[model samples]
Target: MKEGNDDEIWELRLYVAGQTPKSVQAFANLKKICEEYLAGKYRIEVVDLLDNPQLAQGDQILAVPTLVRKLPPPLKKIIGDLSNTERVLVGLDVRRV
Candidate 1:
């Protein structure tokens, strides 16, 4: 399901405190975005801080429901439920084609 000439895989890391409403929404929004824009070229790794708090330190995540782009270099981060598709795409610097 890969698309375009860009063969670089998108490595996304989602950090959440627990199964709270915000965390749930973030995951849903992220999933939808990835499916639409990234499709099969992306991989999402969800990390629950409540289960393993130490994981947050690796990404320097200070807030819950934070999305971190671990690959494609220049690591990018977005904080929120990710309901805003345009902002998320802009923050990730992902082009729409």
Candidate 2:
């Protein structure tokens, strides 16, 4: 894994409808990826759409368990449980294709 600058923090937002199996898995997978690759340079914000449905509009989210890379610029979205590490890394711009 490449080391990120300590001055730059990664902001990640995860949108989920509820504590569904997929949502839970997504969080787990994302956490693992962040811990392994980003380590101390990442922040994860979990937004439950079931609690605040309107929040989805901000990111134009249409699916549950969607991950939005809010920081590091060029915002990105990935929809799924995030079990695929390689795809998530590429989607988050943590790795080049």
Candidate 3:
């Protein structure tokens, strides 16, 4: 198994509105995916739009429950509840071993 080094940290930001069902589900799914694939190499920052509406414009987030990969360059964004693990993995460019 190929393990990621401490230097390769995955900076992820999940933008949501309050604690809506979709937001909650997105967070749960993201956490599961990170734990399974990223392990100790990922960091998730949950951004509540309701609390800081201005944050949305910086990322140009048009929808809720959006997951943004900030680190590792070529920033990627996934919009949805993240129910599809395959899609999430692909979108995040995660290679399964």
Candidate 4:
């Protein structure tokens, strides 16, 4: 769903190395956040670096558990285990403050 008066869609990309614990946590945290804030309004593309390492170059992802907000221009990237929900929400523009 698009924000009223806005035609932009939220495009998210999560880059992970593998099924590591950190990656798992990141996925869980991200999913929770999306469900709470984005619901059916966003698209999450989880990219496993182990399966396709070359895809990392497209966003210059140098670390695992990186969350990239690709749409609406001025792409934003957050690199961490997604242990901090507030930070992730802020980075993704899903929540403020």
Candidate 5:
């Protein structure tokens, strides 16, 4: 699932507060998307806001389940349970063939 010959890596951060239903769903959805689209070219870091609330400020997280694309420049964010694959792909600027 590498985008091109550049060998670029997709750095994603999932911010959640404890193991709520939404948080769990978001993580599951994200993993599915990455496995299908990103494969080995992606890295997911799950950050529990409940454990470290101060980290939220750096990312400006305002919700329970927020997906942050930290690498590849022009950082992007998608906030939700991430049940919509098409929307998630669009939000991450990923075009499926």
Candidate 6:
């Protein structure tokens, strides 16, 4: 099962406000990371908090532009504008230490 875990697909949810500069940059950075590393093995669900603020509670989101890693166990949360791609990637367990 150890081998299976490494190859498992990733599920990521990015919470953001609509059309904000930070949100746009976050998406761009996330997209690049997914393509460069996770590739087709990941899914990013961008949530607009402006529309549904309630969704934040499920993940205990305290801030906008938070990225939550929901799958593959040991769920992790990263808060910010996703200004740091490498940091976010590592925090999400998409890249090893």
Superposing every Cα of model 1 onto the true structure, what RMSD results? 2.6
Per-residue lDDT for 10-39 in model 6, tens only? 888999989799888888888888777776
- Tell me the TM-score of model 4: 0.86
| Span of 10 residues, lowest total lDDT, candidate 1 | 1-10
After superposition, candidate 1 runs with Cα above 4 Å error: 1-5
**Clashing residue pairs found in predicted model 5:** none
How close is every model to the real structure, measured as TM-score? 0.91, 0.95, 0.91, 0.86, 0.92, 0.87
lDDT of 3 at 33: 92
18-95, model 1: which lDDT tens digit per residue? 899999999999999998888778999999998999999898999989999998787999999999988998888785
**Cα displacement (Å) at residue 68, model 6:** 0.4
**lDDT values for all models:** 0.90, 0.93, 0.90, 0.82, 0.90, 0.81
Ten-residue region with minimum lDDT total, candidate 2 = 1-10
- Model 6, runs deviating above 4 Å: 1-6
- Model 4: C-alpha RMSD to truth? 2.6
Error of 4 at 1 (Å): 15
TM-score of 2: 0.95
Model 4: lDDT equals 0.82
RMSD of 5: 2.0
Ten consecutive residues with minimal summed lDDT in candidate 3?
A: 1-10
Residues 2-86 of candidate 5 have per-residue lDDT tens digits of 3543477999999999999999999999999999988888999999999999999999999989999998677999999999998
Which of the numbered candidates is closest to the native, going by highest TM-score? 2
The number of clashing residue pairs in each candidate reads: 0, 0, 0, 0, 0, 0
Evaluate model 1: give its lDDT: 0.90
After the best TM-score superposition of candidate 3, give how far the Cα of residue 51 lies from its true spot, in angstroms.
0.5
Alpha-carbon runs more than 4 Å astray in model 2:
3-6
